[model samples]
Target chain A: AQSVTQLDSQVPVFEEAPVELRCNYSSSVSVYLFWYVQYPNQGLQLLLKYLSGSTLVKGINGFEAEFNKSQTSFHLRKPSVHISDTAEYFCAVSDFLCGGTASKLTFGTGTRLQVTL
Target chain B: SAVISQKPSRDICQRGTSLTIQCQVDSQVTMMFWYRQQPGQSLTLIATANQGSEATYESGFVIDKFPISRPNLTFSTLTVSNMSPEDSSIYLCSASGPGGYTFGSGTRLTVV
Candidate 1:
């Protein structure tokens, strides 16, 4: 079983300012980490994923996240945010055990990002 | 990437009624999943629908309340029975392939 925890419920920042959304997970086995974004009246869109090899993962819309094994954290960051960047962000995890292709995602509660001008 | 098309983008139904949501995938996939997102909450897995087999539902969800159908590899349906205020939420369907997991736009059900 895998679970994800997003530290922030909401984050408010000015346009062009930097922001970081923290996420942590708990699982007994090796896992795949992912970040998804949901806009108003829309479905979830994949941002990035950390399956293997790279700890620093870059996503669309100039967003990036780093996977930390020791801390059990995968935090999303952006150097600059726009008003259109305002949306709900979710962190998810799926078990990556050998030949265990479940594809069932365990998601965080979500963090609402609000960018102001 | 798999393109999922979900019907009934949104609906306002009367209590005690039932609604069936449909999901159509562009490509044939082995597994399709149903999920629910309550007001201001995270996504919860409802069930896993597999072709030629009964859906495997998660705990707290049962076949009586939510029935799933997977007649083929490209299509599936989820019927929400006995609607109530608690059933008001967004229902989403998803599929995974070599590209990644892709989700439908979602159906917003409001039980009044």
Candidate 2:
């Protein structure tokens, strides 16, 4: 079983400012990492995923995340944020033993991003 | 990624009543998952619905309380039975493909 932890519960940033959302995980085996964004009353949208062969992964809406094996972390970053970027972000992990099934996603407590103008 | 459609978007039901949520995927998927998100909390896996077999439920969830049916690769349903105020939450369905995992617009259930 894998578990994910999102360090911040809420982050407030000014529009156009850079932002980072920290995430960490604990797993005994190799796992796939993912980031998902959810707008209010909407479904979760995949931002990016770290499967293999790349430490830095870019995602939709100008977002990116890095997978650091030693740190057991996959933190999401954006050079600049917009009001539209304000939403709840979730970090998830899935054990490869599950055959890449999305149902295996172990999500972290969400971090709410608030972008202000 | 697959496109998923879920309904009814939101509903308020009386306590002791049940609600059934449906999900449809545009493409065939091997696995469909049900999730629950309580107020101010992260999403928790409810069950994994696989065609031609019984749904695999996670710990703390049971088939009697949350029955699931996946008759085909593109469709699945989750029924919440014997509902209570504590059962009120956002129910989401998700599917996975080579592209990535895609989630349906969640169904918000409010039990009163």
Candidate 3:
């Protein structure tokens, strides 16, 4: 069974300040990593995904993440964040399943990014 | 990416009442997924619905409690049966697309 762990449950940062949201996953085989953001009372929006190659993956809203295979981490980062970036971010993992067509996602508990003035 | 349309954005239901959530996709998809997000928790996959096959449910979920139907490649529905306050959560539907995975806006269910 695969699982994702987000170390930070809540991260408060001042607007225009850089921020990093840590994410880690545990899987026996190679897995695909992803970041998703959910605004208040809204559904999830995909931020970025790591399928193959390119450890440094860029996402929307100037967000990016590095896929560290050695450390089993895919941490999301931003050089600067806006007030609109305040939302719940989730880290998910999916692996290629042999004889299975569906790419099931296992998600983390989510990190709430609170951008303040 | 495929667009998913979910109905009844939010609903307040009484205990023991059932609620059915519908999802419609703009394009045909091979796999459709249903997930649940409890208050202040992560999303948990409820089941997988494929056309012309029975829905496959995850652990801690059952067909009796969460009956699913995938009538076609672009449409599916999930019914929360015998609902209670514990069933209050946001139900989301998603589909795999050529670009990536897309999710519906989700249905917020509040049982009282």
Q: Output the number of the DockQ-best candidate.
A: 2
Candidate 2 clashes between residue pairs 3 or more apart in a chain or in different chains: none
TM-score of chain B of each: 0.98, 0.98, 0.98
Comparing candidate 2 with candidate 3, which one achieves the higher lDDT? 3
lDDT of 3 by residue, B8-104 (tens): 8999999999999999999888889999999989999999899999999999999999999999989999999999999999999988765567899
Location of the lowest summed lDDT over 10 successive residues in candidate 2 chain B: B94-103
Off by over 4 Å in 3: A97-100
lDDT of 1 by residue, A1-117 (tens): 789999899999999999999999998988789999999878899999888888999999999999999999999999999999999999999875223135688899999999999
Each candidate's DockQ: 0.52, 0.57, 0.53
Q: For candidate 1, lDDT tens digit of each residue in B14-107?
A: 9999999999999888888999999888899999898999999999999999999999989999999999999999999998776457899999
What TM-score does chain B of candidate 3 reach?
Answer: 0.98
Q: Rank the candidates by lDDT, best first.
A: 3, 1, 2
Interface RMSD of each: 3.0, 2.8, 3.5
lDDT of 2 by residue, B7-69 (tens): 999999999999999999998899889999998789999998999999999999999999999
Query: In terms of docking quality, how is candidate 1 classified?
Result: medium
Candidate 3 chain B: 10-residue stretch with minimal lDDT = B94-103
Query: Model 1 clash pairs?
Result: none
